[model samples]
Target chain A: MTQVHYDKIALIGIGLIGSSLARMIRKAGLAGSITIASRSGHTLAAAKALDLGDHYTTDNAEAVRDADLVIVSVPVGASGQVAEDIAAALKPGSTVTDVGSTKASVIRQMQPHMPSHVQFIPGHPIAGTEQSGPEAGFAELFAGRWCILTPLPDADPDAVARLTRFWEACGSRVDQMDPEHHDMVLAIVSHLPHIIAYNIVGTADDLEMVTESEVIKYSASGFRDFTRLAASDPTMWRDVCLHNKDAILEMLARFSEDLASLQRMIRWGDGDKLFELFTRTRHVRRSIIEAGQDVAVPNFGRNVQAPTDSAKPD
Target chain B: MTQVHYDKIALIGIGLIGSSLARMIRKAGLAGSITIASRSGHTLAAAKALDLGDHYTTDNAEAVRDADLVIVSVPVGASGQVAEDIAAALKPGSTVTDVGSTKASVIRQMQPHMPSHVQFIPGHPIAGTEQSGPEAGFAELFAGRWCILTPLPDADPDAVARLTRFWEACGSRVDQMDPEHHDMVLAIVSHLPHIIAYNIVGTADDLEMVTESEVIKYSASGFRDFTRLAASDPTMWRDVCLHNKDAILEMLARFSEDLASLQRMIRWGDGDKLFELFTRTRHVRRSIIEAGQDVAVPNFGRNVQAPTDSAKPD
Candidate 1:
């Protein structure tokens, strides 16, 4: 009883998102055959153990051969290499996409490598937890999250619509925007938050005056929230920073400027400004909750496994 | 059925933490009566609606008339006023404690106003969410969290132990630290995180280029986490920053230094440094979960209405 959305669906780079997609595709019977490829032999073996796909390989080209759909889920740094490695074997009329955090750079890296026959659509699913690796994936990961497609001006609408429908079935709201806008938007919401978390945690770590136990004990107050974000997979985040330098830097500069003003408020005991800013930020969280983007509590993993229709436990 | 650890417990400033104490005290039969006092008529009305206390008053002095145990849970900025307001009415042998975020200032502000007849103990419970107000409080807010007490050098041992036991009955693990050190520790964990979140959200708001839709739509990536912290009560956090200035500034400096180093890593493409810091931060989350400071999904409000002897809910 497979839905069979594609003749063959290929996944390049079987990490958290990739593995989850593979599993969802299988669960939904969305493909006749699935080929999984990653540069690491160990991950491929793990995929085999889990039987995440019908075929597994280390060679990107071997994985994509004759496939009707190809999804590249790798570090932004590796997008160019993966695009180059798999270009020759990508079948004519196949729809290709990459779930990279930074869309502009991915398009820049992968577009030139496209063999003209494949419809290359650069996309990002605004979904993930701090955890990574094949073992951390679940079928419901994409459900209720957003899938952002950054299609080239010349890209065919039918191909985009088909990909959008595929993500919808996997449980995602789809939106398309210019790649540059996507990059800048991600810089503020995703990249800036991460950089700040990493910075604060690293700062606390190096303090000679405050003992480690103190920070850990008091972390739940607010610092612990940053720690969860700071704990996100580093390799992927570093690539995001490297690949989206201009946007990230722009966002950082703005953030530092805002922080300096806040620091001034504290230094001068300007309670009104601090209070107003704090109160206004509350509305943003309300909007997100209203939009159903976040769980009520901080630990999303538990929310995912809870007996809620929103999170379907296997 | 009142276990009545104390004949009367008075709560000054019945907001999130205070109301929570009222709930837990009633449920556990730990106090013969819970008396809630707040400056705002609106807040007092809300607390009354929640059935959090047996008696309510607008005058702090009137509320503390015969209290055996009095907890002042006001903004750190308002600590001096609350202390001065209630100082004259405190019972001769009563234990007067606080649930303020900062201790040094709380003691400095309140000690001078307090009578020699009462035992003055400064304390804080490191438990909260972005939500505030009386209605937002849950009896389980302090479950498995920490309550830090900074007793004076000459404070009575019996008073300290009894107060510690009271918080313990509320489901908190109690610890002692120097007031100055406590401020320093909280600066890095709670204050800095909230400050950073506020700054980043403000920065996003100031952006003329990226539309609001982009920020909300893409927040799931990382920024959404910061919004939760940013949404915290303004008066509470603003007072925390002003009251804990010296420590907050020190932590801020360290944070900036680490951020500069991270910026250098990104600018130079030094992936390994970023990777190490990122991976190391992940362990802290694990530790927090293990310590039960955080749920596995990390933010489930505890099942407080259930009997304490029952095992944690599945």
Candidate 2:
């Protein structure tokens, strides 16, 4: 039988990450009993319908009571409220962690409400699809992905080690880092990319010269890529923007500065400069593929299916 | 028999689009004989090895001799040179076309050099993967994709119809539009997206605070999407930037303006504004999927594989 890392586990926020963890934990037999909680009764019911956990509750505190490990998977902006709600109910010696995108902001929001007796660790899993909700998750969501944990300076070593084992059991490789460094790294890698995608999609939508229908029809050329990122959950991204403001802004500024130079190259017909930059960027994708962070196949392997002669018009 | 569209089809430039067309035409029996030409002997040899055509040559003019149709699929900057080279040898009444990303620039470059006896149509097939070269092509590359044709004002209707039929047989739906309008539409849908992607990837590469390894390791979070577009063929993209400068500059201005507003919203903590924009962009992705322009699955159907418990860490 698979080893149980936690006797009772509490999941706050039955959204994509939370529900995915529940499914993985159940499939791996990492927990004896699971309690799922969400502020929305609709979401909680969805989790129940999926048979994701042994218990479901609308009350965060009620769900966390007597739980040996608690995972708060709400948006970064909601971390403080969830932390406050479950602080009093957390079992002594229990481990409390989160799956937020921004580390520093989550730490700032949830650290104060964490009880002294419990071990508090802030984590961000670098894995997800653009989909959300409990129904959108699966057991393999975390497999081959990295889960980063940002523990407090004085946190208990045994508790951190136990949480690491729990994530590894769920099919993630864990890395520990400083909360500030995590935010900085993610701003350039995640936050800025999402913001740029949203901005580009919005720009295309608002163009009077080019109709929206044209954008959608010819999107496979390049614009379709941004749409995937832009389609990500708005509420979650809004919170990420609000909570990770500084790092996101810094990265945005850098991106704009670089864009201006690229614009100049285009205006001046500097093909050499454009080629140089374009060539350099290609190496990054190769390295990413080599690192096993992305599929090496072209078009993300979306074109693997054989094309029929009678295929419908795009 | 499928009814051949042309007795002899000459392909000038044996890169991604050129080679894909050769494969498709041969597969569908759309052409009785194929003549492939490339400026570089290396590329000509590659096409010969693939058996992509019935006849292969490094001389563009020789390839076009006695051909019923001539399709030039080189970078936009080289369109004029190819047109000049093949003009003397193009059979009278033969149809001529190109598959460049920009229509107006290609028209401006090739129209003057084209013989009055032959139809000169500027075309852009809104299809491709990041990978390029003669080897990175398949018969299905244009299946279910839109191919826009920008025929000249005085062009023969019979020639245009014949070209449309040819593309249809190769698995593309054809649309006709003004060259200027095509450039404007493509600037927003294709050119701007590539520029923005390249710029962002360059920005991430330049960041001192975030190491390159971190960016690559955590890229699946979002940055990897841009890398695909950014990793596209540099020479082709550079020529696109130079050829479609005016329209691209206009789109870039608008995108930068929108991004500035988005930055201010992030800086001022205007969550409602961010949410509004984010929500609006999601519908665009849905429309693109519904229109058959992109895959409807999350992450472009990249995560469909079952997550094995023994999977290597990403």
Candidate 3:
């Protein structure tokens, strides 16, 4: 267990990331008391039901009143509103951070509302499943994942170090990056992939010739992989696309240009060019596996499951 | 145990599908003897090393001679060549089927060489992992998956029935479709997904601002799902693209148009449209899970593996 770094920790939104952080903080004894708040009554009650924190409230300001560390874990689109809600209640020297996918947008939304005394550190953990909500969280969510901190140039180093320690206690390796650069990097790595997945699933669903049943039945042929990503929280993704407009548009344009070239190769029956691209992409998966970002098991180990599961392959 | 459906079964091309069929046939006693053949001596040797068949040969004709059933599981581009090589040696009343991804192309390529006395049915098993080769095969590969057979209008019913029995013994639900329809359906379901995956991975790799290390480190946030499909066998995909050009190109055009519209929505900050598309696609994943085409387990059950693996989280 880690040291009790904060006397009180406030989680502004008790969803997947917030609840997960609560679990990890509790497990590691990093916080003496945790306060959880959610805009939805059902989510707030669920957090209380799960015993996710020491205090629970639907009022974001009430949760942050006595907290030394406040983490805003709401959707990117809600970051500014959340910041304004709790800005008056933040402690004098408390450290406030957010776990949002789009760093630049989150910083822009939350930075202005922060008090002059509190240090606002924008952070993102590069880990999650397609699942969401309070019960969808687990203590291991951030384990072995990278947690990025994009602090303002004038932010206090001591406060940044403390936040770094908290993430480390949660089993994440922390890295610092400029928020703009972080946005560009994430556009290629995360946002664009999700956008493409959502787009492809939409395309398949709208196809009159190929029925949805056929798409699902034959999905094991590769379509199902995209479905998992496409099935992600729609609100969160919609917010991401809206908030990270410039970077996402840039990546989308690049992706479309590349796809057009690939289409040209297929149209001309240029087997050699098609083969080259297909072959090169194979190595990227290998690199991801080697880097421990993904497992090397075939079908992502889907073929191996508990014997009692009805879907287990016989 | 299922009854032995064929006295002798010959498998041409000991890759993922061929070796898997050999394993299933052996497990169910579906064949009295199994003969495996591949163009590469290395593949033949690997098949022998795995004891995948009773007899192994690099020569397709020698393997097909006197065999009651021949399943060609080579790259689709090689279907015609294999049919030509085995045509003279195929038993008079035997059934020859192929597990190629594209049906119309396979029929166009193999029909001219098929002997009138033998039955030629083009088939595709809507199942596979990214991994390929002999060692990747398992007896349960076809279990709970769909096997689509596209037979000629004049094909013998008896032969088709026997092939259906064989696939049933291997634990698959069978479906029949016109070859052209099959091509169009597969273009949307299989070929297009793989192509998009390969294209996105290529796009990420080509990004100058986003280092490869950044992509790998942050991959768990949706990018990794596409990597698994992108890592599929290049030769097989290249062949699929070359042989099923028209259908794939048509699907690509449809996909690009839809993507362009989605891009417009993002560009114009149309959150409702984005949310509508994203929400609609979630039902497709639900349908796939309900149909037993995919497991509903989170992260595809990757979180269940033992903790000792190097990639384990904490």
What does candidate 2's lDDT look like per residue over B171-252, in tens digits? 8889999999999999999999999999999999998888898898899899999999999999999999999999999999
Q: Which residues of candidate 3, in runs, are more than 4 Å off?
A: A1-4, A305-314, B1-4, B304-314
Residue B164 of candidate 3: its Cα lDDT? 77
For model 3, residues B195-268, the per-residue Cα lDDT tens digits are: 99999999999989889999999998889999998999999999999999999999999999999999999999
Residues B188-209 of candidate 1 have per-residue lDDT tens digits of 8888888988888888877888
- Could you tell me which 10 consecutive residues in candidate 1 chain B have the lowest summed lDDT? B304-313
DockQ per model, Cα: 0.38, 0.64, 0.59
* lDDT (tens digit, per residue) of candidate 3 on A1-314: 33338999999988889998898888778888999999999999999999999988889999999899999998899999999999998999999999999998898888899999899999999988888899988887787789999999999988898888888878778999999999999898899999999888989999999898899899888898889988899999999999999999999999999999999999999999988999999888999889877889899977653323222222
Instruction: Give the winner by TM-score.
Output: 2
The worst-scoring run of ten residues by lDDT in candidate 2 chain B lies at B305-314
RMSD of each: 6.3, 2.2, 2.5
Question: What does the lDDT come to for candidate 1?
Answer: 0.83
Per-residue lDDT value at A274 in model 1: 82
Q: Give model 3's clash tally.
A: 0
Off by over 4 Å in 1: A1-4, A297-314, B1-4, B298-314
